[model samples]
Target: MALNEQLNKFQKQQVKCQSTLSDIASSRTSVGPSRSSVPAAISQRPVATAPVRFSNDTVRLTEINNIRKSPVGSQMKRVIQLLFETRQAFTPEQINEACYVDMRANKAVFDSMRNNSKAYFDGRRFSYKATHDVKDKMQLLSLIKKYPDGIAVSDLKDAYPNVLEDLQALKASKAIWLLYSQEDIAYPNDLKCDMKIEDDFKALFRNKDVPTDMLEVEKELLKIGLKPASNTAERRAAEQMLGVPSKSKQKKKKKQEISKRTKLTNAHLPELFQNLNPSGSQN
Candidate 1:
């Protein structure tokens, strides 16, 4: 009985050791491999990811949100007001810093102002163009008189909003003269020096049957005791009209002729060889 009890105790101890070993094996399996077992290349390799791209609208919205966090009212109005108050030009970045707004948000305002012709942009800077003080015909006339060479009508239009009506009134009263060229210009009229052209002269100019030929025109001028233009400029213009080449063109032709005469060719080689052959024969 003592021997059988000792044998049973030994068998129970062995079974317990086996169960502990099995539990350890199962735990190891559940935990996965150790860090040391992973390959070095895979462990060190960088993971690939897709790059992030934002659309124009998303970027614009983000910029607006970022800028709108400030206490400023309208970004555009603030920029314009700043420019007007300072009466100076500013770049988008400068304007942003001055108004404490983002440049991206202000750019849209600048573009809108430019498109609407409410502001002036000289490639890099923006300025309020309608800051002129002229408000009526008298002021407009005074402004015109200040510039003897004349002022551009477009500039006047910018200076005074209702400048067109005032300009017509001034012209009717002979207070100013409008000269049309590539651009319309306003010149202050001096009635003392202004000569009235006869209606007959205007009629002659407007007549379709009036001679278009230069010689016929010259004859009419001669009949009226008026001499045709005899200045160097007039002569050159006449020469151009007659299809005569200019002095520069004539010089170019002369240079070409001289070059052709001086140029040596294979055709001259035979003569040169003949001259040399006579000397060779004498030798």
Candidate 2:
């Protein structure tokens, strides 16, 4: 009986050892994290994504395309404001940048501005032409400011050309007419006369052949706060070289010639009549 009891006790001890080993392994097998573990496993979540909105032009893609709120109305008003601000002439890329397109507008916005525009074109770049008549001349003038009297057509795009048409028009109309004459002075004939202000402003009382007294005339006009007819130092210099018109001088010369002719005719009259004796006798 003692031997059997001891065997049973030994078997029970073996069973307890096995149970401890199993418990230790089971504790390890439990999903609970250990002190040595880097971290516990956590439920995974999908990454948040922005809404995709692809448009026709890949070059114009922007982050704001996925905006949840509708800014269409306010954005449109601002775009319109910018459009009116474009009263000044501009190039295409210049206009696009001014509209703050990417930040405020999209491809649709630019399309809307261009939708009704018949005068604008994109070539070489973009240009908003005025009427073709004015457009070409304005362009030519713009070039002429950089290039003086003459420039070549082939070189104009990069090397400006002379625009004679505009100039000839200005010259013919005498919009830049030189003051050529001093006529009968009516209201307040004084150079400093307030009455002459209107004529001065209208450029009607130009000193057509300015006298040797041109400086004196200008000084007197200045004394009365009246600006001289000239617009520039060069113009004043031009007017300075100006003299009384040949037309008026010609009239004076003709009058003198007529007076001399009248005197000579009177003096020769008696002699000529006497020399007509043969004709008179025949009569």
Report the C-alpha lDDT of model 2 over 96-210, residue by residue, as the tens digit.
Answer: 4554333223555445445434234353233332222233545544544443333333232221123345444533543322222343111111223334346454454343434
Native-structure RMSD, model 2: 29.0
Lowest-sum lDDT 10-residue window in model 1: 271-280
Decoy 2 TM-score against native: 0.19
lDDT tens per residue, model 1, 94-185? 77557545545545555665664456788888876674567677878898898889888888775644679899899999888899999999
Per-candidate TM-score against the hidden true structure: 0.30, 0.19
lDDT of each: 0.65, 0.42
Give the lDDT of residue 186 in candidate 2. 11
